[model samples]
Target: MIIIIAGIGRIGYTLAKSLCDKGHDIVLIDSDKEICNKVSAEIDALIIHGDCTKTKTLEEAGIEDADIYIAVTGKEEVNLMSSLLAKSYGVDKTIARISEIEYKDVFERLGVDVVVSPELIAANYIEKLIDRPGILDLTIIGRGEAEILEFIIPEKSKVAYKKIKDLGRPQDYLIIAIYEGSELKIPSGDIELKPGDRVLVLVKKDAVDIIRKMFLE
Candidate 1:
């Protein structure tokens, strides 16, 4: 994929590195010359120093042929303008990093392909640490209507000694994977649940409270 990224801050730099490592064609643009020089020296992608919201600068970054354009600058207006400009230049997809809590609906209504809020993402991650410390991580999908969660089995869990299929998990929920130490295994009907195992389960969002009461309580 040909990806054009605007901004060279921590999030942008890390994203560029990870995507480049996956073998994507990347073009990184930032107005700061020093940061551009540093990032260009470290990554194999093309790095340009320019205002991302400007058409000429975006042209220099090859936005006309880009498959994806991402704006991660700290300023919400700049990010939005960059993404909108990329879209105008025929980029197939555009994503913008947003900071304001109230502008999300407006961004979606304006047809931004994706909007990521660092604050919201960080808050959600922290919530996992406090609400379900036993879970490694959790993802809410379909507008928070469903979720996939990772949980470690405690010694006293009621299902610890039961067979996987005999745990009485609701029909709408499913245990997808099990991690025993470093090994990850797919759960099967006959597989026996054990203490010290980590499990990933998919469930409806509304059913989470019920599931937690039955298993974690």
Candidate 2:
């Protein structure tokens, strides 16, 4: 896939690197020449030193043929304008990172494909980390109707010594995998949950409380 990334800041640079590593064609644009050069040197992608909101710059970056266009500048206005321009130029999909909460509704109303608020995402992540210290990460899918949670087995967990199938797990929730130390293994019915094990589980939104009671609490 060809991805055009606007703003070669920390988030943009990281995203470009990850996509480039996956063998995607990435075009990075930034107003700061130093940042553009620095990131270009680190990754195998085309880097252009120009403002994303400018039509000429975007045209030079081949926005017309872009599969995905992402605007992640710190300024919300710039990100929004750049995304709109990308869409107008025939980019297949446009994603923009916004800082102001009020603009989210506007973005949705404008038919923006995706709008991400780093602050909100970070706050939620931090809150989850604080509330569930054993949880390594959490991803909401099915439009937030379902969640995938990664948790480390605590020594005091009730199910720590029990077999996978004996935990009385609800049908809506499924244990997907278990990581014992450095080894990742699919959890089998006979496999016993042990302390220090990292477990990945998929649960429906309605079953979240059950998951909390069973694993978190």
Candidate 3:
């Protein structure tokens, strides 16, 4: 995947490095030349020093062939405009980061594929951590309609030691993956979930409490 990340701040830099480590082609754009220079030396990605909202910079960053364009600048206006511009340039997907809680709807209405608010996400994450100690990680996706939760299967979990098939089909949630020690395995009908195994579950927001109780309580 060819990904263009606008902004070289903490989030953009981290995203670029992680994506590059995953063997994806990443291009970074930023208005700060010094940050770009510093980031260029640290991350294995193409760095363009320019405004992401500008077509000239987008062209320089090869927006025409970009599979994904992510605008995560500190400025919400820049992020929104850059994403809109990327969409116009034929990028397959556009993700914009906004700090304002109220502009999510407007940004989506303007055609951004994903609108992320760092503050909102952080608050949710912290809330989950306090409310659900069993959860190790929580990623809200599908526009907040669903979440992917990572947790360890407790010894007393109702679903532990049971084959996935026996856990009941046509369920409200899906156990996608299990990590046993150092090995990662995809969930299947006959695979029995063992206690202490790390599990990744994809479930709707409404089903979170139900699954948490079954596994954590």
Candidate 4:
């Protein structure tokens, strides 16, 4: 995929590096010459030194052929404008990083494919950590309406030593994978769950509270 990223700050740099490592073509736009130079030295990606919101700069960054365009500059206006311009330039996807939660509706109405709020996400993550002590990890899917959660089976849990088939196949969630010691396996109906086994479950958002009571309690 050809991805164009505006800004090379901490968030942008980390995301660009990760995507580049996955063998995707990346082009970065930033007004800071030093930051661009620093990133150019560290990664194999094209760096453009110019205002990302400018049409000429975006054209030079090959925006017309870009599969994804992400704006993560410190300034919210710049990010929103860059994303809007990228979409106008026919970029397949446009994503903007916004600091203020209130600006989300306007950005969405302006045709930004996605709006990400780092602060809000961090706050929610912290809240989840405090609320669900037994949850190992949580990944929101389908616009936060569902989740893929990683958890460990406790020794005293009722489900321990029980075959998955006997549970009548949980209607609200699906056990996707299991990690027994060092081995990871896709769970089957007849598989017996053991204490301390790490499991991955895809669950409906509304059913999370009930599932937690059944397994984590």
Candidate 5:
């Protein structure tokens, strides 16, 4: 998928890296030319130094061909304009990050496909979304008290060959399911986790380090 990201802020950059690592074609836009140059050498993506809210800049970023356009700048107004411009160019999906919670309805009413609020979501660039390789995805819930995580079991994981019930997991975290190849299996007590399998877990945020020590270390 061809994804164009505007802003290059913390969430924007992290999202770009995550998508790029997943083998997607990515084009990044930022007004700061220095950061553009710095990011070019670090990630496998096209870096465009320009204001994403402008028509010429969006055109230069090839917005029409973008499968998804995301605006995650600190300024909600810029994000709004950039995503609207991308939608006008016929981009199928558009996502915007906004700090102001009240504007979410307005953004959606104005044709933005998805509106994300940093305060409401556990994905507030909070934790390991791109902080580690095997940890595929993460979401914080209960106001940072708990987290939902999707992690691929590493080959060197301590409990890879162990049964779900045999691991002596703490009460705070639960192994929700195991994904093997294309199939999803409920984590039965007898189900032995495999190295290549992906596991979805819900854990207390404070106890995540223990979960990592077992599955990601």
Candidate 6:
């Protein structure tokens, strides 16, 4: 996928690097010439040194063919306007990072596909960690209908040394993958749970409590 990212600050630069590492085509825009020149040489991406809110600048960054348009400048106005222009040009998806939580609903209503509040997301992650001490990670998927969770099996746990097919409420959850000592393995009925194995599972939203009690508690 070709992704056009406006603003090459910390967030934008990090995102570009990750996507570029994944073999996605990336185009980056920013007003700082030195930063653009530096990143252009270091990262495998097309860098445009211009204001993204301008039509000429966005066109230079190949907005017309961008599969994903992301606006994440520190300033909200620039991010909003650039995303709007990208959407008008029929970009397949548009994402904007907003500092203000109040504008999230309004931005989505105006045709922005996604509005992200970094602060809120971070806070929620911290709260989840505090509430669920054993859950390594949690991602709410399908808009709350399902979830993807990561957990590391503890020694002497009830599920340890058990086969995948013997887990509690297997009908309500799917063991997708397992991470064991730097290796990732696809789960199957014959796979046995072991201590310190990091497991990734997808489950129905309502099954989270049950699974937590079975493995985490």
By TM-score, the best candidate is 4
Highest lDDT against the true fold, candidate = 4
**Candidate 5 — which residues are off by over 4 angstroms?**
122-186, 189-217
Query: Which sequence of candidate numbers ranks them by TM-score, best first?
Result: 4, 1, 2, 6, 3, 5
Worst 10 residues of 6 by lDDT: 208-217
Instruction: Give me candidate 2's TM-score against the actual structure.
Output: 0.88
Q: Decide which is better by TM-score, 1 or 3.
A: 1
In order, candidate lDDTs are: 0.86, 0.87, 0.90, 0.90, 0.87, 0.90
In model 5, what is the error at residue 211, expressed in angstroms?
20
lDDT of 3: 0.90
- Number of colliding residue pairs in model 6: 0
Clashes of each: 0, 0, 0, 0, 0, 0
Off by over 4 Å in 6: 179-186, 190-196
Query: How well does model 2 score by local distance difference test?
Result: 0.87
Model 2: per-residue Cα lDDT over 1-217, one tens digit each: 9999998888998899899999999999999988887877799999999988899999999998999999998898898889999989888899999987789999877867999998988887688668755667888786788889887878888888999889875588889989999998988899999988889999887886678568755
Question: Per-residue lDDT tens digits of candidate 6, residues 1-217?
Answer: 9999998988999999999999999999999999999999889999999999999999999988999999999988888899999999999999999998999988998889999988888887788678777888888786678888899988867889999988778788898999998999999999999989999889888878788667754
Which digits, one per residue and each the tens of the lDDT, describe model 4 over residues 1-217?
9999999999999999999999999999999999889889998999999999899999999999999999999999999999999999888899999999999999999999899999999999889767877888998897898888888999887778998887643888999999999899888988999999999988898988777666765
TM-score of 4: 0.93
Residue ranges of candidate 4 with Cα displaced over 4 Å = none
Listed in order, each prediction's TM-score against the native is 0.92, 0.88, 0.74, 0.93, 0.62, 0.84
Better of 2 and 4 by TM-score: 4
Inter-residue clash pairs, candidate 5: none
Q: Report the lDDT tens digits of candidate 5 across residue range 1-217.
A: 9999998878878999999999999999999999999999988999999989899999999988999999988899999998999999999999999887899999999999999886666545544665545667887676678888888888898888998878866586998878999999988889999989989899998788778777877
